[model samples]
Target chain A: MTDSPIVLVKPVLPALDKLGAALHEVLRSGVLTNDGSRVHAFEALLSARLGIADLAVCGSGTTAIQLACGALGLSGEVIVPAAAFPAVAQGVRRGSCTPVAVDAERTFLTLDPDAVAAAITPRTEGIVAVQTFGCPADVDALAAIARSAGIPLIFDAATCWGITYRDRPLLAYGDVSTLSLHAMKLTHSVEGGAVMSTVHPIADKVRRLRNFGIGAEGALPAGTNARMSELHAAVGAVVLGEADAEIVRRIQVREWYMDALRHTEWLRPVPFRPGAWPNVAAMAVRLRPDAPVDAPTLCDELKRDGVHARAYFTGRYRPRPIGTAGPTPVADELGKRIVCLPFWGGLTESDVMRVVDAIDRIGGGRCHESHALSLEYPG
Target chain B: MTDSPIVLVKPVLPALDKLGAALHEVLRSGVLTNDGSRVHAFEALLSARLGIADLAVCGSGTTAIQLACGALGLSGEVIVPAAAFPAVAQGVRRGSCTPVAVDAERTFLTLDPDAVAAAITPRTEGIVAVQTFGCPADVDALAAIARSAGIPLIFDAATCWGITYRDRPLLAYGDVSTLSLHAMKLTHSVEGGAVMSTVHPIADKVRRLRNFGIGAEGALPAGTNARMSELHAAVGAVVLGEADAEIVRRIQVREWYMDALRHTEWLRPVPFRPGAWPNVAAMAVRLRPDAPVDAPTLCDELKRDGVHARAYFTGRYRPRPIGTAGPTPVADELGKRIVCLPFWGGLTESDVMRVVDAIDRIGGGRCHESHALSLEYPG
Candidate 1:
């Protein structure tokens, strides 16, 4: 087989005809932003599909999380998982709160409710939990802890679009959940995000906060410009309309990788709970403790074969430990071992087999043998 | 005369063929954002046109200012003009700094060098000045004051895209300048902004700051997702290429309104200094102290005539006054009396005339009589 480069993610553009019609409609309306009709329509469509109420679309996922934190008036200390993206910590800091890092569970790689329960204090204002790698967090347990502590729970569900817990939308778990529609996600809007809230008043506050805090009465509050443009909304409306089909395709690709990698002793896939239905936003594998090669070495080997694999979340999320919580040893270990494989809707079964074959060759034995294999597989 | 509803601002969409072609390129490239090629191209094109050294495109004008402030490492109390948009103050606050409101010059309606000078203290970290309504501020004087104080100056040149001071770009006035390309601006992306700096280091920092502060080494700083999408950048590139022509067209529209309203006794246009080339981004009329109607009353009458006139500032920018500076009486008064009229490239000389005629009839006599005059112009 001829070696071909595989990217970790590729955005699936919506059908050209539908996208063109939406763009034309935007041009005709002559309203490019400020919660225009396209934004409203996209919001309505997403809310209906997600079986939620009061979905507010904004510029990007980070901003959605930031706005949700701001609307909830989060301050003092915010508890977050150490193994998440840097944007979660950045959002907490942006919302004028300090981040307290806690470890993720070893098996599922989601925020551990026990760690979160131990991290809370009198100064804790909120909890920002992550649905890591589209694996649903223990939202019920987290929510219970937050309620006992009288703090809000904000799910950094950036990669959890179309994901479900107990056969219901995973977004319905937290007080407010933020969804990312970035290009690398399973579904996207070029660059966009949405804040999903069950509370009407909180959603109303988010609506005002995203638009620079200008309410109907011309009064002001602390807000910034997080408004999503009509053009972006138009793209989102089209992509969201076809998200179900895209999810199905991604699931097939994911299953192919899982089946192919089942015989590999050194690589382990992060397991999800039985009742959870994840969008399969990414295909991440963990190197076993006794693996012959580390994640970085394996990634380098893949690179030599024209395959682009990445060591995911290596020192990008954890900053200096804050709050009274202790070090997150599990997250620290996983951060060095987790590697994200190239998985997307466009990948065929052959592509999956090729990737699996490359990994197998690289992990077969000593460094010199892997080097020879890489040379043989070069394009 | 038939009553025709006029909006305050209308975005001028690029030619259908060109815009469609640009969108197709975005789809083909499959790179939605994260400093894509289109964003780089747009920045280059805009920098060349504006004659600036370093230009960074971002999500919104507010984010541009916030990034500039962050790049400058601004903290403590920063001085700002009271009559400017709320985004200015919000940007300062978002940067973890405090905004000290100061008065504007009565005639120029831009930041007063004297007020800014008086507002400075040992704790003052920077100065944020505005080029109000495309009118040039006393850039040299303000720069001199900042230099003497050893502080950086940031110009909120949001509405001054095509504006020039003494035949030079208005952006050259400050240490860093921000431009808005919102749909309502003279030249726009669907939603975008740019930060221009003569100092390359500051500009580089801003570029990093806008993309979550992830440097090449993977080290993170305090940053959020302020990236402009490729589609928005493509729109910006096309709009910027034809900006000169758009500016020319808008100048004609501005001149027609100015000449038509020259005879009005109760309304006065904000004056621009000689040797300045203003972009005419907005058409604002100040109600003379002896005018028969207040700004709100006039806006109400105009609304009845199917014209949307709006009160300009209306207490949006001011926060609890800080520093040793006195109250901004001039900004306080102007905030109530200044009204922005409908203006855009789509408006014709006839539309200007109709607006002028409605204002004339409304201001000529008793307020109740104006209602009768508005009723005569039906849809």
Candidate 2:
């Protein structure tokens, strides 16, 4: 069934020799994990590359989010953007906090700072802002709201490792910014994540939390083995060496889709915010309301055309967004029609043209079976 | 600081050629994680080797424990063995359940079935039994208690991959048996774990929980990214081939220590259950109260002799065991004076003799400083 010639996000890895060397070093050291020297090396490299002083590498981006929530001592309600991978909300739940989802602004498709402030109640302990598809959230506005509410702000920077705004890294904001180093990300340690923050104490807490809460004195109240293995760190170190090139290639791929779909009436590319650079985790395209075919049709047609595209996060929102706030029209509209096209580095112009050719043959906006519309990503 | 020649558990890895081929295949196919083909192959291989039909490979042993609790629909208080690693209770807490730790039986240092049965209250939801240092728990008795209570039985079988009792793998009992394929264990996937069970549905639930709760149709209520990467699985597959030989070697090392220390009055080997076989995760020695310096001094002395030994789980219970039950004398006795010797596969008879020689020069039991007794596996 998965015979598609091209798929969404074919990871761009380092040269085989670099990865092999890293693996060899891990094998030689016999320190498979437990925040070993290899993990330390990767953390240092990531810190230097991202220009952040405090960071903790963990098992996955979800683990990074989990660590942040755990370190912050958050309880009660955590405000989350409706338009995100459900894992963002799951992170909150895993930390023993309730997730109160709110709508994102139409312009950037990020958490609406106004909605977030309005959603805050005495039960709210923190706010979780997600950079969807590498679209930067309004960090300054969100930070202001957090300060006013006296709640910690956590940015799920899973997709924006290289993203920047006004020449400052988008990750530099928030009490804790969690990054995904999964294979799908521009820079990954095979399967790992990091909890980055300017708040040194929080970063320290995350370290303790990841190591089963064991500190110098003794075991803390709680912690889990959310540590990155040496092998994974080796992969991350090797991958980080080529991250810049990979990010640039990803941008090029995004542009290829954008340029090819510029004149097409059936679909449109999601635009970036001003002075906000993107890492383009997913090159999402919005199917026009007047387009002949709906999202599932476009997804099905693309697959038939030997292209593997996904309608990401469409199920989490649309047909009534799942959250505290009711009637999130902007999120509903965007969520129901969004389709992430085949995107990744090393994609040729010809591949983009093939994807574009398939999209141009859109039909009338007709709904398929209800089950087909329930797209929540490889569930 | 880690310059000791004989440390606790220098991981026995597969040949470089085998590991290299496995990693090369993972690199060849771009699926680095998310239970890909490599993970499937490893799980299949593990199933065949361990003689289990239903299982799920996850991120770590802790994740395996977490998945079991989450899958069993546990919430409320959970019964845990005080003699196990602190992670067992932490896993219960991560599953949003309160850990009601009870003392293990004095014999095998495993959860006493009677104690477990007594600990069960109206609020109790499940039981988490840990196979401390590869010693098999009274599985039949524990299972019977769990069945009587109508609560699920989950064994934190982190150290008993190759261990068997009554001609059956120790993992074959319980509602769900979790394994830690950590580098310190008999067989490892670099840093991996598994949930094994005769209850097929629970195994299926664990698979979903590890995968962000996303299933064939949609998202389940709660889940986490506890996924084993393809690289890790590749490592596991290669490592499993040599696991039997590794187990045999580990058993040999255990025997060597036992033989060398047979007549020593200072410290002696902990006894194993009659029908139970051990994988020998740690060759623990109980320091006689009347013998030479306390566990810390012994540990310090071992280190001084270029043998890096550890006092595992001493801190969590020694001063005062952390759990619902108050003042557990057996746990206190076992937890305070127990020290695990430098034990692992590949330890020669020469190494055993050296360790025994150091123990032979035992002094009167003395507590130099209170700070020195806080030995808990590198904090």
Candidate 3:
């Protein structure tokens, strides 16, 4: 039997005994959530790792994005990347704001400053730039655009935790940044998230928002439950301790894919932003237009060959109001070309070889487009 | 010196060893969330125990309320009780609807059906009736009102689990019932919630809503992240096993409160609805208008005397449209008189006696008002 099909996302978990011991103590205290000590310790641990002084862990990435919007008091239209997960737009709406989708930049599939600037209007209250596929966005330019417009900039760095750009954590850029500690991510706390801020007192508001807006008096009526349970926090703490090393292992997995495809003419690895570190969350490659098989067909072939590959973010992208999107030509075009392969910290070199071989067997046509090369996979 | 101050809401937890064993199984699977097997098992366990065929565990009680709304596709004015926890109103708002606050019944401080009918408008989409302090609302009447108005009725049974009304589950009467498993509750799974429905396929919709509305294609725009983690489900399964018995202990503790207050004249126990069994979540009483110490002062004095008590629902409440209320006189007056004492499954007769002794020492005023004497303590 050809190797048991390598799954798309296999989580790298902490030692069972280690996480279990910490959880027993949580049960003994009779405080499972409502910002228990475990949650505090998990937050402190994440703060040290991300170097964020003001941060609050959230129930999920969508909740974190919504909390960030609540913290900033942004209730009008917010600018978001057109080429992002649907949760990003949903979170903006959850914060009682409409999302205006702007086209992503061609280089990194992240928010384009020019597109965001063009989409601004009197109703635009903020901007939520996404770190698409572990690729750093043009943060400085977007920040400048936000400053000129007198609006806040939030980064939905959901898929790019532990990644750095220009020697600084990529999430350290925007006014507020959110992380998704979903099970599929490189590092996770089992269905958890965090909202982080380096500018203003955003994190303080996020904390209040996470707890149903309850102050000393009572609930302020502008919040819902977004608290991460102590059980989640304990797992997070144990998993977080090994995140740096786990991320390094994921990086190694990405290189294995790079090595396997170096000589292939039909595909090239996505060019992440220069000086940006990779968490290997999105080990995607763009197919040559002239290749024998299309993205959907190739994905089918890979599945048949006992290899799992996905055309990530290829679902129906409907922004609310339907007319709020700026002409996202780059994002729209990239959707058809990019395909993500099974990549994780535990993925071996043989798995990468099997993936590349599946690609070689499927393609028969020989055509290459010059229009959207992004960057050539170096030989 | 004061028997550890008789604190309010000490959770009755499952044995550490039992919970830890289940949790370790979750760790071994490395599937922390996204509807893992553990979540499925926990939902099944809850469904069997509650005798509801359709149920879904949510991230928290607040999230459960919102998810139930999403499942029903409600988006306009929803009616809620004025004399209830702020989360009831907040959940309605989070569901993307403006809440119309109806006055609570004078007897049980639950939703008054007459007030609910008066508050309804052409824009009224649904009704959310709360089980205030484990006191069942007039479910049969509220259901009739909702049906005649062609709107759905939801029950927020956050504080009243395993309690019955007329030999039926208090939760079984509504279109959908939600529960809060917050740590302070008599039965808990740390920070968790559940949505239950018997009338329609509400649980199916809730499952989609909790999972970011992802179907075969991709995420629909109307969903946010509200999935409960496997870690939470593991703890819930164990804690749920003991909820029925623990609830019995809580009822016994409540009887001790009744016995201690038999001769008291300044306070009277809240008269719960007829044929309704108590979960003892709210061992609350209303102070006499002419009592020397009002609710707040009594609360303060109780604190000094090593007893903990709270003036439940005494905070500033602002319904979305300030004019949505239909003159909630009963609820407005009741807010000033109600007080919640220290309550839990393990409360002792001695602790109950200590609490009554503190109340006896604090109040010297003998004036009585006829407006809100729901019922008298038997002498």
Candidate 4:
């Protein structure tokens, strides 16, 4: 049998064009390195648009998280959601902290306040609450839990751009929030991220850590280089300038998909809270019980039809030692059912409709449904 | 008094036109993110040129070292030079290991072989030997020490690009060697580095660690994103492509500076071993007793004449600990006295002569030296 055509995970046309233009300027100046004019401009633009005062651009999201954690002096136990990407937990681990896995809230695939509260121990120094699928988690609630416990909270807002609650940006809530501008993000800087902090000391420390831990006028501290170059910053600047329009388009496409799948039994779109506007970074749907299909089966069928769907963050962060806690209830539940459909700035309503139609066709006992149903039912 | 004229650190005119063209293509293609065609090409070209098969590209020299340490599973005590860049020690510490600072050989200004032998304890898992100032160190000696002790040796050869020893590339002698292609290096890739290993397994592991620990076919280990973008890689490829001719020019400039200052009383260039072909990355000289100027004073005088000389790793890694065995003799001596003059592909012989003339005037205590000496050394 012929293998199905591959749909690119992220067809990053806008980023490519913007980055290309940035590269042209880099080429023109023959100044490919340094915290040059373009990089400085990007940092300023990103900070202003995000409603934050201080932002130091760095090499990648991982680097951003590492910088923040290193600066914040995160060394003991860090509470992390088992439902999030592996990078979050890994960042904590890389910073010499033990990642104490926390359960997520079933309603929204985010860190459960109760789980975070329960996981807090004398060793707990920080909490990494990821804003899953672009939906801003209950930061106010999460912050309360962390503050009362006297631990810092880091928002891995990699997926939650263009989101605001109560007229303030979602990222404005945390002590330090890390934003990723990868090709897959609503606004991309090719490969870049930033650590935003209202605290001058934290921001200053982050700046030093990002630049090999060197104080502005002194020698470097014991640290690795995590700097974002001028080319990346230039691309980030252009993307930030164009993101508003892109977000509008993404929101429209998301609405179109929601409308088409509202009555479909197999596909249940994850609910969002009122007044919580997201960038539509991804459209996630949970498989319903009465549905004739399961997530993996439906996903495989959709791929056959050129409607790419992914099991985002599935098995990304496994539970500790297998039998210890077994698994976080929310992580186990969400990992098996949630699927992310094709989403990007260039995605059209037609593409969304095609995905819905494909899912509608494959809702029956096709492919892996029998296997999934057998597992779903205990024999 | 009017401030001295600010000289451009790197007058990047030769490749400006080409860069503009590359940026134009980037703008058109919109493939702005990781391992784009340019980046892939650069990596392939670099691997072949460096004569290393197991090489993985990353965001920076610091990231590269971290990846190497991660790949090698270094989690105990890492021995490094006390007179090297702080990043070396910091990178080791970042890996959750204790950074044991060892004295370097005073002659080579590299890691002291005897110091490495002494720093080894039950916890010592590896050694990070830096090839300071683009000159290949006594790698054979360091290699023998690491091999005899049954520990891995990671050559922090960030500054040793294009240098050969014993008719073979200096990088081939170590278990794994890392190269920096930062904007400051002779042939930079804007901001990038690579880890090369002769052993296939370690190389494969290095590749995975740098890229979020995702295996070729298995699940990704929890790792950070340390990928080098195509745009940066493309720039690197162009530089590497022209490296042969570029190396010749840089070496010629090095020889020119050496000849111009052959009779200077106050500063003596660091001695190179016979058959030790250096890459001429940076020109450094020791402050002589008869000279009327110190390193800082001479640097100031040269800067006023459109030359940018820098203090070479002064107090970068120092003051080991109260009970720790103190400084490496060669590294200690050079760390205090060595000052590097401008060395880039863009600098002409005439520009070099101008720099030499400025140094000559300062050494003779003609104009700027008297003022510099007072401000720099207030005693």
Root-mean-square deviation of every model: 3.3, 5.4, 4.1, 4.8
DockQ of each: 0.45, 0.40, 0.48, 0.40
Point to the candidate with the largest lDDT: 1
Residues B1-379 of candidate 2: C-alpha lDDT, one tens digit per residue? 2334777787778778778878988897878987799888888898998889898899889888888888888888899877667678777777767788788888788888878877888888999988777778888899899899999989898988888888889888788899999888888988889999976467678778887777545565458888999999999988898888888898899888877776666577878778888646788888777654677668887787687777765663221224665445677677567888888788889888777765664331232123232221122
Give DockQ: model 3. 0.48
* Ranked candidates, highest TM-score first: 1, 3, 2, 4
Better of 1 and 2 by DockQ: 1
Residue-level lDDT tens digits of model 4 in A1-379 = 1234324345345545555656666666655546678877887788888878877777777777777788887777788887876677667766667777778888888888887787777888988888888777888899899889988999898866788867788777688988888766877777888888764356667666776665434444324677778777777777677788878888887889888776565568887755678647778888866556566666777777777787755653342222112258778777678888877766667666666667765753342454342232121
Which candidate, 3 or 4, would have the higher DockQ against the true structure? 3
Candidate 1 lDDT, A1-379, residue by residue in tens: 6656877788878778788788877876778888888888888988898888778888888888888888887768899888877788777776667788888888888889998998888989999998888888887799899999998999888988888889888877788998998878867788888888775346677777777776545434357788989998889888887788888998899889988888776787878767888647788899887677888778889888778887766754344333437878888788678999998888999888889888877776444343343334333
Q: What is the lDDT of residue B301 in candidate 3?
A: 82
Clashes of 3: 3
Model 1 root-mean-square deviation = 3.3
Q: Which ten residues in a row have the lowest lDDT in candidate 4 chain B?
A: B370-379
Candidate whose DockQ is highest: 3
Calculate each model's fnat, 2 decimals.
0.40, 0.41, 0.52, 0.41
Scoring only the A-chain of each prediction against the true A-chain gives TM-scores of 0.92, 0.91, 0.92, 0.88
Question: Per-residue CA lDDT of candidate 4, range B1-379, in tens?
Answer: 2234334345223356575566566556666655567766777787788777778787778777777887887777888877777667766665656677788776657777877787788878998888787667677788888888899998888877788877877666688888888877766778888888876456566556666664423234335777888667766766676677767878787888888777665677877766768656677677764457666666666776667787655653343331234655665566557788777666667776777666766665542354343232122
Residue pairs that clash (backbone atoms under 3 angstroms), model 2? A292-A363, A292-A364, A292-A365, A293-A363, B292-B363
Candidate 1 at residue B209, lDDT?
A: 75
